[model samples]
Target: MFTDLALGALGHPRDLPTALELAARHGFGGVDPDVGHLRGLRSRTQVQELADDLTSRGLRWGIGGLPVSLTAAPAVFAEQLAALPQVAEILAAAGVGAVGTWVKPMDDALTYRRNWRLHVGRLALVAGVLDDAGIRLGLEYVGPKTFWSTERFPFVHTLAELRELIADAGAGNVGVILDTYHWYTAGETPADLRALTASDIISVDLNDARDDRERDEQQDQDRRLPGTTGVIDLSGFVDVLVELGYDGPVKAEPFLSTLAERPVDDVLAEVSDLLDRALAPAQELSRS
Candidate 1:
């Protein structure tokens, strides 16, 4: 795994060119593309220019957020799905292999069974479009009782359930966006990760939960930078990914508001340090 820069995910958003330059300047290996920013590139030539920028800096494009929202109305979903080809073409040309989105774990309308079928059908369509462009689709599971437990339908919020959705999606390009926060909150173990091949995952989000709360009591929005708190078993999770030979970008997605209020350069440098420090010990020990 490599440290990836995702300023927007950390509550500090930057334009694509600025993000790439800052990532390289701060020593990041990859920078996750902002799809909205990418949408402005009108042609393959523009994308090539962007890709060349990345190559020049010895950097790579990390996973982009799937532009389609899972809970969109049928018409809205169709509209977004329709625009995907152009998006995919640009991304594939720029050497971005995969895009990711989260499975909405709760639904006030459709029950789990109904929601599952909707997902299978729609994502099969999304994956088909992405497949043609040689891009893969990664689905993330949202685990946290606070998010899914209520007087509503709780859907796939666990890794196993996420896989079930992928299996049902029945597309070769479908994969997982396994986040350390959800894995720990779902009570998944190293053995769970051991079961996956590197190809089954498109990316990983490294983060830590609040140390004062029980796993189930944790709020999804309240998170800490990886290695800030040992409340989650990051070592075990990282070790398993290493043993499995996972070579994807692993970024921190701590939802702290303080980061948003800080200077972009300072925040990026600090987050870069946090993510690098989180992975350094394991890598050093392995080399030793």
Candidate 2:
């Protein structure tokens, strides 16, 4: 697996070129660019220039979210769906092969049953657009119980449920974006990883949870750096992915407020060091 940097995890704004340079300087193999920032580019040549810059720095283009909101009202959703084809073309031109977004937890306005069905239909449409442009779509499920308490019905909070949703969506180009924090919060085991093929996973996020909090109580923004806590089996998770022959990008996404408060350089250095330790076991296993 390759190391990637999610610009969002930095909790700060950065342009595409600066983000890429940071990724290269901090030993990341790739970076997930903020596609929204590139919406102003009106020419294919501009996209190619960004791609060429990434190539020059030996960095791969990673995943980003589509500009459309699939969870809105029917009319709004349709409008977003209609615009996705153009977004897909732009992403394809930039050499970004995949995009992803989170499956938000249950909210007051939507019931679980309705939300689930809505997501299946919406994602199917998204998958069609990405497939036509030769791009992949990664779907992430929120695992925290705090949000689940708001809805009376069962929600998609586990990897198994997330997989079911993908199957229901019936899109060949769609897959999961596995996050260590969510995996642990949802009580997913290493066996879950073993059951998955490389094709089932589009990308990965590496982070740890606060040891003091219960598994179900850990908040998203309170995450710790990988290998800094024992709340998640990150090494085992990596080993399983390695054994499964998954070669996608594995990015650090610690959402700690302290990390956000720190200098960007310091945060990058710490994340790079922690991730190296977390992946060491998997690297050794691969060599053997």
Candidate 3:
């Protein structure tokens, strides 16, 4: 997998043009596409220009946030769903192969069974549109118990449960967005990664847990960049990806609110360097 840059998750939400420049300068192999930046381009020519810019910078298009909200009321969902085809087409033409969104681990109202059905049906429809345009949709599961336990009803928060959810959807284009924070919190092992084929995943997010926190006490937002704390087996995660022959974007998604306090340049360089270090073992394995 290629090291990708996710600006917003790192608290550096800049325009796509600026993001691209930063990504190139910092040695990111890929950069997350801004859906808004893409939608702003009215014509195919504009989209091609954007795609060509990525090519010129030697950057791959990374997964984008799903524009359609899965948890919206039926009417609101239908409204958002209506506009997806246009967006999907633009993304497809721009050569973005994947887009993703997270599933809420808990709900105050809907029980697990109800939520499952809602997600399956909605995802099938969404996947249908995306698949038509040759793009895939990835769904990330919220894995921290600290966050999920807050609501009255709990939903899928484990890799196994999310895999079941994906299987239930039965969409060829629907797959997992594996975040290391969730994988670690869910108590999954390298075996879980080994069990999955490359096609079973759409993307990967890397993060390290807090050193002071126990596994169950881990908060969703409390995270460090991969390999910084050695609290997460980020190297093993990368090693497994390499062994699986997975070829996709693997990005650091440390949702630390304090990231905004640090200099953006430092954050970008640090993330890039960390990913390089994390991937070093895997790189050596591949070369050998």
* Model number with the top lDDT: 3
Compute the lDDT of residue 224 as modeled in candidate 2: 81
**What is every candidate's alpha-carbon RMSD to the true fold?**
1.6, 1.6, 1.1
Report the C-alpha lDDT of model 3 over 247-278, residue by residue, as the tens digit.
88989998989888999999998899988888
User: What is the per-residue lDDT of model 1 for residues 63-106, given as tens digits with 9 covering 90 to 100?
Assistant: 99899987899999999999999889878888898899998898
Clash total of candidate 3: 0
Ranking the candidates on TM-score from highest down gives 3, 1, 2
Query: What is candidate 2's CA lDDT for residue 236?
Result: 84
Local error of candidate 1 at 219, Å? 0.6
Model 3 is weakest, by summed lDDT over 10 consecutive residues, at 278-287
**lDDT against true structure, model 1:** 0.88
- Among the numbered candidates, top TM-score falls to 3
TM-score against native, each model:
0.95, 0.95, 0.97
In order of lDDT, best first, we have 3, 1, 2
What is the lDDT for 152 in model 2?
Answer: 61
Name the better of 1 and 2 by TM-score. Answer: 1
Kindly provide the TM-score of model 1 when superposed on the true structure, using C-alpha atoms.
Answer: 0.95
Better of 2 and 3 by lDDT: 3
